[model samples]
Target chain A: MKDITEKPMQQWISKDNKAEKALKRVKQNTTARIGIGRSGARYKTDAFLRFWADQSAASDAVFTEVTPETIVNLGLFEIKTKCRSKFEMITRPDWGRIIEKDQQQILKEKCVKDPDVQIYFGDGLSSPSISANAEDMLQVLKLGLEHEGLSVGTPFFVRYCRVNTARTIGPLLNAKVVCVLIGERPGMQTDESMSAYIAYKPHPQMLESEYTVVSNISRHGIAPVEAAAHIVELILKISKAKKSGISL
Target chain B: MNNSEQAFISAGIDIGTTTTQVIFSKIRIKDTSGFGFIPKISITDKKIIYRSRIHLTPLTHENEIDALAVKELILNEYAKAGIAPSDIESGAVIITGESAEKRNAKAVTAAISEIAGNFVVAAAGGKLESVLAGKGSGAMTLSKKTGKRVANLDIGGGTTNICLFNNGKVEEAICVDIGGRLIRIDSDKISYSSAKIKECIKNLGLNIKEGQNIYNNNIVSDLETIASSMTSYLTYCIDPEMSLPKEWKDSPNTRLSNRPDIITISGGVADCIEKITSDSFAYGDIGILLGRKIKESTLTNTSFYQKSDETVNATVIGAGNFSFEISGSTIDYRNSTFPLKNVQIIDIEIDNTASTIKRKIEQFCSEYQNSTFALAAEGIKCPTFKQIEETAKLISSVFNFPEYQNKPVIIIIKEDMAKAFGQALRRKLDNNRQVICIDGIDCGIGDYIDIAKPVASGQAVPVVVKTLIF
Candidate 1:
């Protein structure tokens, strides 16, 4: 089914078009669809099918769940937000942001406290992103921070998660910084995209402006390993600036 | 919180066969990225604030460039423009035309660049000059904007540099020894004539030499013929359909493989093309005569011909505004300083096997001893994390041979994978080696790269890739 959308964008332009060379050159810089020829005032069959495939992929990404093996392999025990299922997490966004009191206690007891940086993975909208990118990104990120002579706290996974979970985790664990590597809402160009929402000394009262974001982390975008390296640098900056987002 | 803007002063100095010129420009870089996105820093504008008066190039009796006089000229221009050397940041110092062949050309350029700016890189060689002139003459911008093939002929005093740009990218560039000042007439005598132009004169059944009187010996028609010959040589270099004479087939020209849709002419000789002079020897050279011939030639009548706004200042303007390029937004660097210069690029193909890659690196290591060179390649496309790790492992084998163990290992990838690759490679090398891996920079073998300080809030670095090819 991906045959339609899987072809390189540079080669997707119609062969007979005289502007194929120019179109191919422009395609190298962007991911948006362009120069897809029309047929009788409608998208060509291939273009239409590619669009449909991308749409379906986005929906599939939202509904699916990360496999148990992925969680166990990452060497992290699982915790859940207040929401129990995907439907509740989508309908009640507030509930999706909170960790239960018992789980918070467990997080405090099990996780390292007073660390310079705390990293966590969240399958927000796309479960596939965590299973795909978390291990590699976390490896690079931990090594990068450790190389900078900063202490990195334990990593964990939170199911049915949202971005605001970092606000709670940072204060509960007495961490200086909290960075959530979470799955992003899928777009037509890619479904595997993820984002890193980083904040300094986060708490329930922190404003939205306090969170510094580095988004579009995936193989199709900024490769996870690369994004992780950048995130490591950002964490170091936050420690010096003593702030993130607009202030930093 | 909001978009950030950074502006810096840049200086460009061009020492040519007939003239020496300098220009100061204000280059502004802007962060165009919106919230929730990575910083996308780009050079937003380049404004030429001051242009120096073109001066005659000082030459020693030995035909070498008078380095002190040239340095003094540049320093005077800087003072006149009210710019301190410390105010300038990034630019290029280029030696063009036949002056680049002088015995002291390299030393002169180095001295000028050192006094010009902290980050100014001294650059020469015909290929970089051709591209710079094309950029400065506005032909390259037009091609990029219109998506048309544009070719520029920068006809200076002792050499004509030809570069063809296809939709804003350099296709090919060549420099030919066809210019106006190759034969200079002083009042009633031919003061100087190069050996090559003398051979050209002999081909026309004329005996011309240095220190010969030519005031009444039909010099006008002979000079016209010579100017027309030079014009023909330029056309032969750029136009695919224009065949050279039998003897000129093996001449000093690197012709464009594909014909351009538009053509532009610039440089000192180009300054004379727009106007005709009653006195042909006004500049004590055939520059005006050559311009008159080009104006009246069939080459100008072609529908593809376009007049360039910048004539004498094209290469200098290009040096000021176009030498630096931003690297990919996502890159990796550690324990490195700004402005690493003259690092040779060793382009290698990463084959499927690691041993084959090791052998290639071994060859490069032996070939480039006592020098710093980066390993560059068009890396894997949309590589998985595993693939990136494997490729990094393959490249880390360079450390096995002691040539790359302690020194800063620089890797340039054409693909957008340097961040991931650098991270993985750093891990393989025990997280302590100074690894600088960058991407979205396109450079090849026989080219040298210079890296400037981090810009766009440290998202990327500025790089100057100087290519030298015949």
Candidate 2:
């Protein structure tokens, strides 16, 4: 393995020079890597270094914890899945889908029962993603729901969570619709990408097709405020159709 | 609202010196984003549905445009096209070349654009007229296909507009008062000649006056001298001995470093030249003779002449298709006070200090009469949380100034950070004033923007950047 402290080779050779301008124009229109000139059929030093850096960022996003300030700023109480530790949470994904009995009792006592809409923030795989996007996303979601005269239930954050956590809480709080904003699996391109999974009348036996998802909610992807706006509209459409995902 | 395909009716009308024409088109806008992805709306298709027959521009006896007659002509064509004025959603109306110099030109153009329905109709100057004609004549595409520079010479009734295209994009342009109808011939009688034409006649050492019944040989040779002078302007980038009009002298060439690869001719004169008719009295003027002389002129430059796809109707077709842009779907703005028109857009550089941002706003306040100005900037490149917060704080500080305390702050960023920046700005302002911040549309200083209300998706707004000042 290359030394983590050393920088990669950054030089690129070109005779035409105009190719550099054309490459810049192409690069501005897309996020995909293009025009990274090679050296003797090998990757350039900068390119190799950038690849490793992004890989480390993706892993760091998965291992880090959500900041306490973010939770407090959004006024969200904490909950945890049945998984005891981060190692066990990654090894046994099934445990992350189930809330413990004690946590279920806490949710039932605190959340508003039979609400029109319930919202959740989960640090699925990337804690930094939630901390980066959750504040603005939560505010917009609340404002949009309130503007349409729909009551939102008590919101909370879940640690070591999964998308199926919504399935567990929907029955406990008796929510008509459950929307969970969770961090997506980290990719080398971006680690802060988040996804919003929404289900109408979610239950334990609900198929994956019954849940609608809006992925790529981040600064590098869709702006969080715009994502919330889209989510509000999507939820309204799902409610009117009484369906989601493929059905809607 | 259904997230499906939506179509809007658009119109393009060109009122030039010699002819007036209109074209109606249908633009199909749809959400191109895939399932489970953020919405991305774009104009996927444009089809010309109706093309009006070319009509002679109505002129008054006093040498000005006949406004009522022009209005009636457009109305009659709309009736023939089987569409009401309300059918046109967006498009442009260009009063080009000599027609733009008429006494009631602005009013007539504005009225025609208003009559065409809810569309943008602004008069275009010579430079823009040349670019539009080149785009309409397919010279732009030809340059792109060959990967070479092409210069379009649109020779109309009163001026020859030249637009240079390098790799399918317009680089520079110039328009000179050299055209076919500058010398009017009425049944062998030299009935009238513009002052510019008389100067050319004197330079050619020909005894010609307004009332002389000149022979065809004398007029044809005189037309050849004038055509050679125009070609010399194209070749040398400078007219010798002020043979052509001197108005465009100060507007000199900066892009003629090397000879263009190809030169294409369009407009009415080009139509007559390509037809190659023997009769000199065609169209009751020396237009045919002038065209033939221009074609036969010996240009020493290496540029080769090529035929254009469109001749007389180039500007009209280009005005129809190339002026409107659909904004990115995910924009941030208030819906209640939209469909704004004629908003002056001022370009700003991203400032690092709060005082600089205030100074920029103050400079804009002193420069323009309108209280509301759209500030455009190349926003934060990465748009991280810290960058967004700093940008928002700077903008909110400018808005909080005493001069613009209660006014709405409008920001137009070139980057895709409009929503987040707007949200941050709102938090900073504490919802004190209205803020409309939209991105995904690139515009520069001195360009006016017309933003329509949000479409059915309720996320994006249709935008038209009006090049009114230039």
Best by lDDT: 1
lDDT of 1 by residue, A121-196 (tens): 9999999888778988888888778877889998999999999998889988899989999999998877889999
The iRMS of model 1 comes to 2.5
| TM-scores computed on chain B for all candidates | 0.95, 0.88
Against the true structure, whose TM-score is highest? 1
Judge the docking of candidate 1 as incorrect, acceptable, medium or high: acceptable
In candidate 1, which residue ranges exceed 4 Å CA deviation?
A8-11, A14-18, A25-34, A37-46, A101-114, B1-3, B247-250, B349-369, B381-383, B387-406, B419-435, B456-459, B468-470
DockQ of the two-chain complex in candidate 1: 0.45
Model 1, CA-based lDDT = 0.84
| Candidate 1 residue-wise lDDT at A151 | 93
lDDT of 1 by residue, B1-470 (tens): 33778887888889999999999999888877777765667888999999999899999853799999999998999999999988877889989878998888989987887788778889888889999999999998989877899999999999988888988888888888988899888776889987778878877777666787776677777878888888887777777888885435447656788989998999998878887677878998889999988988866778888999798999999899998788887788877887788888877775647667566666766887667778888887667667776778887876645755766789998887787678778777856677899898888878898888887667788888888543
**Candidate 2 residue-wise lDDT, A79-183, digit = tens:** 899987777778999999999999988888888888889999999998888878888788777766765568889999999899998788998898888999999
